[model samples]
Target: MKITVLSDTHMPRMSKEWPAPLLQDIQDSDLIFHAGDWSDISVYEELTSMGKVHGVTGNTDLTMIRGILPEQTIIEAGGKRFGLVHGHHGKGSTEANAIAAFSGEQVDCIIFGHSHIPLLKQDGKCLLFNPGSPTDKRRQPQYSHGVITIDGDIHAEHVFYDSKS
Candidate 1:
């Protein structure tokens, strides 16, 4: 399975649409994981039009979005357990908060977003991934997202670009 991960889109506010390259990536992916701060339900609608989307609600999401999405969730894909969160709940730093969200759960990977910073690391037996913001790279050098490929083992990497337009 090929999964495209992204978050902090903050859309129509960030951009009216996905960047050309990002859009292509989304179209080509087998699944999509949006960690949140979508800000509008239209973003959900737009993404769903392209493919399956598993997402959590961010602190900045509209009420309707919050009503439809959970603050955190876990899904099984390609025999791997993925814990997804917006990383705004609980205490401490965003990364800490995300880890706390699934503290007692057995997840192969913890995927989160809140700070709009791309991250890829190993947390013991689990993988930690934050795909950053393709539309809102607040202070990062470039816009970015992540791709995770699952066959027998899982592998992930970021795809960075110079522009969001």
Candidate 2:
């Protein structure tokens, strides 16, 4: 299964629509995961047109987004468990907080966003992945997202580009 991962889109605040690269990835994937900060529910509707979407709500999300998405979620695909979170705990580092969110959980991977800083690393028994922000890169030089291919094992990769569209 090929899963496209993204987060912190921030919608009209960041861009008018999905970035070209990310849109293509969404079209070419088996599933899509948004770690949150979408800001608008229209973003969710747009993504659903491409494929199945699994997501969480972020601190910046409004009532509609929060009503539809959870603070965190767990999904099983290709025999692997994925934990998704926005990592905005109204506190410290997003990465560290994300890890803590899934602490003691039985997940093979923890996917999160909130910092707009791309990250991919192993944390104890789980793979810690942050797809960054495709439409809102913040101070980062490139806009980015992630793709996870699951065969017999799980493989996660970050896809970065110089432009959002």
Q: Give lDDT tens digits, candidate 1, residues 58-137.
A: 99999999999999999999999999999988779889999999989999999999999999999999999999999999
- Model 1 lDDT, full chain set: 0.93
Q: Residue 1 CA error for candidate 2 (Å)?
A: 0.7
**So what's the TM-score on candidate 2?**
0.96
Worst 10 residues of 2 by lDDT: 88-97
Error of 1 at 134 (Å): 0.5
- After best superposition, candidate 1 residue 115: deviation in angstroms? 0.7
Candidate 1, TM-score vs. the true structure? Answer: 0.98
